[model samples]
Target: MDISLVAGLLALGAAVGFAAGMLGIGGGMLLVPFMTMLFTAKHFPQEHIVHMAIATSLATIMFTSISSVRAHHARRAVLWRVVKLLAPGILIGSWVGPWIGAQLNSSTLALAFAVFVAFSGTQMLLDKKPAAARELPPAPGMFAAGGVIGVLAGLVGAGGGFVSVPFMTWCNVKIHNAVATSAALGFPIALAGTLSNIYFGMKVPDLPASSLGFIYLPALLVISLASVSTAPLGARTAHSLPVKTLKKVFALLLYSLASYMLYKAFG
Candidate 1:
C-alpha cells in the first residue's frame, strides 16, 4: 500500500475510534461516509463505493464492538438475558438485511442509510428520559425488536446501538445498562453483516486487489486495531459524562452526517 494511503487509514481509524469511545455508538455511521468519500476520491468505480464502504466498516466494527463489550461486561452492565432473547432474530435478520441491500442501486442504498440515520438521530435528540419499564421485556418483544434492529444494522453496517439502546431503554432497561448491552450486541451485527457482504459481493468483478468480496483487508486491519485501542478510553469517559447531554451532541453530529450522506446520494 502507498504510504499516503496507510497514513490516511490510520487517521481515519483514530477518528472513528474516538467517536466510538465517546458516544457508545458503533463507528459505522462515521466510518461509512468517510470511506465512501475516500473511495470516490481514489476514482474507484462509482457502483462499488458504497459496497466497499459498508463492508469495510462492518469488518472493522467487529473489533470495535469486542473492545467496547469487554469494557461494559467488566462493569456487569450487559444484560445477557436480553442478548439471549434477541440473538436468534438478530442472527437471521443481519444475514438477510445485507443481501437485500446488495440488490439495490448504490444511490438507493445510500439514501436508505441516510434516512435511517436521520430518524435515529432525531429519536435520540427527542428522548428525554428512560422509558417507564425498568426490566427486560418478555422474550417475544425482545425478539421482535432484535429482528428490526439487526436488519437496520446490517443495511447500514452499524453496531445496532443506535436502535438497540433506545429500544432497550424503552423496555425499561436502565440507560447505562442499555448502552452497555447494546454494545455487546454489536458482535452479532458485525458477524452477520460481514458474512452477507462477502456472499453478496462474490460475483462482482474488478474489485481492488486487497478486497475479500466487499471488504478491503488492509483498511479493515488498520481501522480495527486503532478503534479497539481507543474503545476502552471511550467507555471510561462514558461513565463520567452526563449521558443525556452527550446523547444530544452525538445526535446533532449524526444529523449533520446524515444530511451530507443524503446530498451525496442525490447529487
Candidate 2:
C-alpha cells in the first residue's frame, strides 16, 4: 500500500468525479484511461488490463452516479418517469454489452471505444437543436432508445449520457431534465456492466490481488471514495454554468477521450 499511489488515485478520482456530475456522464470516459494507466504501471497482464480497467471504472460509476443524481434530485431536475421508461432496455442491453466486449481484443475494443466516443464528442460540439414542437417518444420508443444507449454505453464503458442527453433534448425535454434523467440512467448501466465484468473475469488467470472479477478493490476504494465526494461539487457547479459553456466543455472532454483511445488503439 503505497501512500503516494493511493493519493494519486484519489486525485484522479476527484477530477473525473467532478466532470461526471458536471457533464451528466458516468465518468467512464475518463475513468477508463486513468485506470488503464494505473493498471499498466502496476504491471498487470496486458490481455486483461483494459478489461479490468473498464470493469473497475463501471463499479466506481455505480457510486458516482448516485452521488450526482442526489445532487440533481435536490434541484428537482431529475425526471423519474423518463428514467423508469429507459431503465428496462438499458438493463438488458447493458448485460449483453460486457459479454461481447470481453470477447474483443484490446486493440479492437480500444478502436471501437474511440469511434463511439468521437461520435459522442461530435454530437456534443454540434449541440444541434431539435424542432421546438417535437415531443418525447412513447414508451416503446423510449425503450428502444434506451437499448441503443445501453449497448453503446456498455461497449464504450460510458454512462450513456453522451447519447441520452441529446436524445432527450431532441425529444423536446428540457436540457436540465435530459441531463438529470441521464444521470439516473447511469445507475442501471453501471450495475449491469459491473456484474457482467465480474462474471467474465472470475475464472481468468493473473488478475491482480483484491480483485472482484474485473474490479480492483484497492483502486475501487480510493477512486470511488474521492469521486463520490466530489460528484456533488460537480453537480452544484453544473447548475451555475451556462448551457452553451457546459456543452462546449463536454465536447472538448469527449474529444480528448476519443483521441486518447484512438492513440491507444492505433499508435
lDDT of 2 by residue, 211-230 (tens): 99878889888988999999
Report the Cα lDDT for residue 239, model 2.
89
Report lDDT (Cα) of residue 121, candidate 1: 85
* Candidate 2 local Cα displacement, residue 65, angstroms: 1.1
Question: For candidate 2, what is the lDDT?
Answer: 0.86
Question: Candidate 2: where is the Cα deviation over 4 Å?
Answer: none
RMSD of each: 1.6, 1.2
Candidate 1 C-alpha lDDT tens digits along 1-267 = 777777888888887776766665678888889888888888888998888898899888888988887887888878888888988788888888888888888899899889998988887888756545466667887788789988998988887877887677666666678777877788888899999999888878988888998898888998887888888887777767786876786689789889878988999
Alpha carbon deviation, residue 158, candidate 1 (Å): 0.7
Worst 10 residues of 2 by lDDT: 33-42
| C-alpha TM-scores of all predictions | 0.95, 0.96
Measured by lDDT, the strongest candidate is 2
Q: Candidate 1 — what's its lDDT? A: 0.82
